[model samples]
Target: MSANPFSLQSLSRTEAAVDPAFVFDGTMVSRAEFSEKVERTAAWLAAQGIGKGDVVAVWLVNRIEWIALLFAAARIGAVVAAVNTRYRSAEVAHLLKLSGAKLMVVEAAFRAIDFAAILADIARSEVPALQKLAVVGADAVPAHWPSVRFDAFDKPYPPAPTTQEDVDLPVLLYTTSGTTKGPKLVAHSQRTLATHAASVAQALKLDPQRHFLLAMLPFCGTFGMTSLLGFIAAGATIHALDAFEAAPALKILSENRITHSFGSDEMFRRILSLTDAPRPFPHLEICGFAAFQPGWRELAAEAEARGMKLFGLYGSSEVQALFSIACPSDAFADRIEGGGWPMSPDAKVRVRDTETGQLVAAGVSGEIEISAPSRFLGYFNNPEATHEAITADGFFRTGDVGRLRGDNVFVYETRAGDAMRLGGFLVAPGEIEDELKACTGVADAQVVAVDLKGNARCVAFVIPASEPPQQDKLFARLRERLAGYKVPARIYVVDAFPVTDSANGVKIQRARLRTMAMERIAAE
Candidate 1:
């Protein structure tokens, strides 16, 4: 981490021949073994007519193939368009065409997921730029999209290509979404990812020796992929999992003594409830939590009390994951709040008042902007959007609301759009949601603000816990626990919240909730 010894081109090459690099199920893959795969996969990409700057869409889970293909594509100076396996027909088709992918490598079959069948539904006319489609776990290939069954290695690893490698070469294209009609493809160069990986490893205190890491998250998202790269930069042994399941993840973490891992609060809470030991994760060093769901505070407190070091994290596809880590040498409460110091030493953060459009003073919340080494080059094929997102001074205007804590340290509050201006004062919906959740019979809650005839009003959507929560009791609790203005204008009980899947994880569609709230109010 002090000096990143591994880059995209030299990833598995620098390690000792017999050094353990990846472990899957009960098998271990040595650096030499993995390096051979990288070479073979590089040759495969070349054989498929993929060249420099071309895109190779990967529609697979977290496995050795996913990792190998990433380095392989980098070896050939091509970009890897990491596609989330959870994506369906339309999403898959959109991403494939959006990236204009030259080749797509996917798992033919994973669990009950029939990837080949899904791809069959997509017409070849949609992805005309695609030259090849390779699938693992099966031998047969579709007629419209031909393949040699990627894992067979029918052809030998051709001589290493004569292409060149540079730190600024585009090597990654991650699919991300905002309030746009379609998802944006985030572009990143070799230098940005390598540098961030090294910085994160150094900040998190990872070592190749004795630090066994788990690839629990999917490789399609920056959150999981960046963690994998951090493992590579640290040269630590990786336990690659195809997908995440609480029962299996617990077994792997406990049996392998995984030193570091990262995931959402809901994921960790499930693991916590299922484990019987007082010190469930005794050997865990630092488990980063995203605080993605309700009850995160309780989950964080319980995890720390069990001897596990759980720290908060903040990052996005544009910045790559682990952009800002709250793992400073501070108290647990402070450290577990996301947006501490930038992982990159050269990075700086500033806050700008939404209304004034000027930099804010210490402890005042505003839009958080960052200038960092790991900042993305731009959104792929979206020049207008890119120009709008980056400021003149080169800071990425992160649409996230946060505050500067006086010393280059910062505290990320919420997404600027999600931050509500209730009663003429800015407030975080999490406060209201948490209050509503603490009420009897409330399983989960989401808060949103809508403009009603000339006034902004806060409203809530709740997922009930078995029995629907009574609005009278919910209002009573909100009045007892929070300010009067912060109380939600109404609450609607439902079986589940609206969600959309991404590489990161399942995210509640807050925008959709706002629309629903507006309609509900209009009908009043």
Candidate 2:
């Protein structure tokens, strides 16, 4: 590969010309057929007036077409902004508007929410830059907007040619997990994505002989997106699922003879919980997951007993997905305990003192900062936020606390700020607190993450104005306002918050609140 590799057009052409590419649901799509699909999708996008440098928002679940549109956008110079399928009207509108998406490709509905209706409502003023809408699983376009059936855009047009210089241009914009605030768009180029994908594939020892099963994680997320691309780059067969269901996921893992897969500790626990009977996969070799806590360690042991090797991974959207991933040759303890080796030689990781900003000793834990070639360009349309994240000398502050050992392995400790990882997504307690404050009978709200059964669980403490808040009503409000993962597992109403006297001002002592939450849960 050169400094600027050939665009997806050339790569897909070469790969397809050599062998078949993807196997989804039970159907296998040959390389030649996949190339044709990409070309056809690119033609349709061009016909819709989407060309070089344009932004298209994709709101769909994991499927072959989602992957097709990703490469098709790369075939031209257009950028794809992935929207989380779990997002509601407000969340979807904010992403589309912030990314300045000119076109939106979405499904009619996933589960119960009518996405078509939501998109139609937001199209008027929330997302003014949006010009056209193409919907999948819909019979006809809705009235009162410029819309078209996703399949109707298939009128043939020639695939556009791309240059090496264009490969370095922005091609993908993914949203951060909103650890502190609302999600921010992180930009990446074809060069960065390709390099990162290849590095991950090499680290995971992926090959054409392996079959990958993707469940739980959505393609809109960095974790799933990079895994999909890395396996494709390795020419591996893919088995995709729109969502994670224990029985179906287990069936796929056993029936397909899946060799590799990725998921969260909770996801794996659920799959294992389905039955006490031994579920074995002789062909399954590698499994990648997050959160290497004690509970996760037991799960890893159980998985190993059944013939699959589980390893811990540490990364974020800012680092182009997996900055550090466990390799297959690593020891069982190291693979399960450490965050693995850095993906590239060009990537440097170091820890700094939180207050002094001085370099910490190699074995000392502190804030983890990284300088990598595969780092994202910056937060789109927000230079201030970008400057805040990336240091003056080009190092990106990961906001994660970890230590680098003597053997060059990184061990993750915890998040530096109020952010917590729940259900494999980095979430900010403030987001949940905001929703809680909006609830009736709530005067003030404070949220802290506490470890429950080895998974991060949000615990909300409320200060009521009138009377003690009802947990049922507050939970009902949260269900309507936020995603399911953001809903607090336990709620408590108190007269006042625990505070500490400080030189600056009185500050709420979250550590004490966390202790209170733990005691409450333990007592229950």
Candidate 3:
């Protein structure tokens, strides 16, 4: 057995101990076979003189080759930069330059996008840092750059010994949502991410028998990579997807016998819609969700109706998987009403009064802070951001509002990031959305502050059920749950939110919806 303490290399090590003939993507890539492949890739990479601390950017989608590349990077102590496959030329170029990647692995054609053309454009640009580029699943190398096919590179190579620290910097950076700047790079060491995976795997009770169907992107983002690493660390199988679509996902779930899955609240909604037509994915035992907007019960009921239990998960890019609400017992409900139940092991979470910066009572609403070992190292190349996001005591300022319930559970209310003043009072969109979610016929709700006559007004967007949701009924419900001033001044009963594609099952991108709302209001 290898002496490595905490690298993804342990994936093969553990799998070898259990079932070596595990089915990974139809073919049975045994532990011995998988280890040999990883070694071959590592040896090929080492031949290129790519050693410790080198950055290798993977520009492909979810595939066996990608996993090979990732493990290879881990073995050689190279930082793996999982490039977002959705990026266009400009976005791709920016990440390549920012990550300072020395090698890139891509395919000839990905869906409709031409990787060769994009590389050609990038090579023409001023980014002279990139040295080698390999094309996977391609026959001929493009004239723009020297390349080898992914299969041709596969060779019989012996596995090399590596240390616990050898995998320390396997993952270099995370691609943010680009709300303020161009996707600020959130950096993490392998130890940090491995710690995160340990927590997540423990929470899910993942083992070799646990098969998870991944319904998100395959990038360096926390949501994506965490799913990959967490499953791998648990010696489990992960069914990958290029993207999430409801109908196809349902089909895959049923056919693959996928037991566990997760997505944003929007994703659950889409899965619910599929079951609404015909019962889809009856085999799914557990499903997790994060709400960009509140009102998960409808989707939960839909999943339950289809034989799947739904659980709420609260996490962020800074902290991979913070906490989860699996059971809606008194403790869970009370925690949700307050904010969220603390679900992390040894993760110090507290709600601090915004005014005093002092820890608040269990039920009091305050800024949520977390101190955990798995916390991200820092934002890449941005010390000011690192300082601003974390405190002197090492507690990461989550910018979320919540409270704790005793020592075990933590409850969250709203995000400190979205706090805006309205009529000389602080307004929280989550409060408004939660109230709207309680409204009859309102399947889901999301609220954002919009400037009206120089004063912020709550703009509530709702997704109604099959029946036409009565606007008057919803307004009355909000009146009961919220203050008159806090009630959304303007309500829009949208058939579906444009930002959050609930049809796909994930958090609704509020930034996209905010822009759409502004455009629609202007048109009116």
Candidate 4:
């Protein structure tokens, strides 16, 4: 591989040279037009005095303009701090503050979200680092807010491509989904982003000639952003949606002959359940999904019975998404697993026993660790956390429990925190959750272990298919299928489970469920 591919400007230009770079917001953006936007956006960044090492905040949904900002920041050697559109005032404030973003470019209004009002909630002095506000989707800046329109109509590109030509300089920051201690900004340079994209394109076996991917995932997260980068790296065209909806998205996937795309299991289930369109989406060859919400049936098997091809995916903000993926040729049993062979040929995956603190052999469940090219430089401005995450031997402790197959691949299981000890046995909650799903009318199940009177016991939260199931019936079914220890101590019915969005996808907030489960048990 040539070092030429690692250049962000070169990659931008190469991708922009394609006939139609993107179909977004109901209009086709030509290659030349896309290139011009990159130049214009880069020029605007220069005019704003956003030079090397400065952070430019992006707070919008999936749009071509968002992609343009990414290229623009990379071109000017500035770092882009992406803010999730789903975030509210406090979350948004924290991200802007954590990244020390000097300029924030956000849409004035988006659907039901009053972005301007959210901005109003934070006083001018709230984020001291934010110097200027660049508003999109508005004709003029409001009186109270000192801001400029994100209009780069007649701006000129800088005389030179960059003041700093190093691709190793940080160019993007993805915020990690944190709990007790808030989110950490995960920084990645042009080299890592470019190399990882190229490696993923190869691993996915993408060809610009025929393969086209639907950009349904939100670009604020790693899963969405990495897929976008992979498409650009492969010189493939993308059809992007500003916002993802099931009906519209399904229509696009069916009509466009989409060959490769990535999303979550929830997204696919919704699309598949929308309408009986004679098994629609025939051309969808590679639909990589993260099992954010664990289900009873193997989604891949179910999807394959239809025309669509589905496979599991594994990645996080720290290592970046698509670090590993299930191959298209993998059997459904293997395809349903979260972990897969690394996209980078040089990437190393190993397991370390959490209790023994020693590397584990194949088929032994332990912490999944990786030494890969896709790994982030470190948690930005948080050296202590970064030090604790990566081992001295260079492997990143993924904080995920998994077992390596004898081959080069591995299988990701539940999170280390989510794994529970039930009746003196270390157990995966999914095991009990699956059995719970087998009960009559059980749509889904979330099992959590609650410490009850010094003994760890399993508690289940279930969403019904049409109506809540009989608690005694569900418990009886689990008792018949699983061992006495594996059965949930009690089962509770609910309309839906609670979930939170992260760098991965929409994940069920197990901690919240655990709290609810304990309360329910105590009240009984």
True-structure lDDT of candidate 2: 0.75
lDDT per residue as tens, model 1, 126-210: 8898777787777655636777578624468564475767658678998876445768899998888887887887777776777
All candidates' TM-scores? 0.93, 0.77, 0.83, 0.93
User: Could you tell which candidate, 1 or 3, scores higher by lDDT?
Assistant: 1
Candidate 3, residues 1-524, lDDT tens digits: the string is: 33565666664455323443234345555566777777788877776557787888887766667777777777777877767776767777777787777877786786787776766666545456677777777755564555665552455444444534554553657666655446667777767776667666676666666455544545445666776677666777666666666666666676876777766667667756765545566667667666554565555665666666666656677776534455445443342243344445777777777877688777666788887767788877678989999989998888887666666466655667566455656566776776777666777788877776666777788888667678888778778777777877678878776543222234566666666667767777
Q: What is candidate 1's CA lDDT for residue 409?
A: 88
lDDT of each: 0.81, 0.75, 0.66, 0.82
Pairwise TM-score winner, candidates 2 and 4: 4
| Least well predicted 10-residue stretch by lDDT in candidate 2 | 10-19
lDDT of 2 at 333: 73
Candidate 1 TM-score, C-alpha based: 0.93
The true-versus-predicted C-alpha distance at residue 310 of model 1, in Å, is 1.8
Which residue window of length 10 is worst by lDDT in model 1?
1-10
How many residue pairs collide in each prediction?
0, 0, 14, 0
lDDT of 2 by residue, 307-349 (tens): 6678777778888666787767778877876467887767888
Of the candidates numbered 1 and 2, which has the greater lDDT value?
1
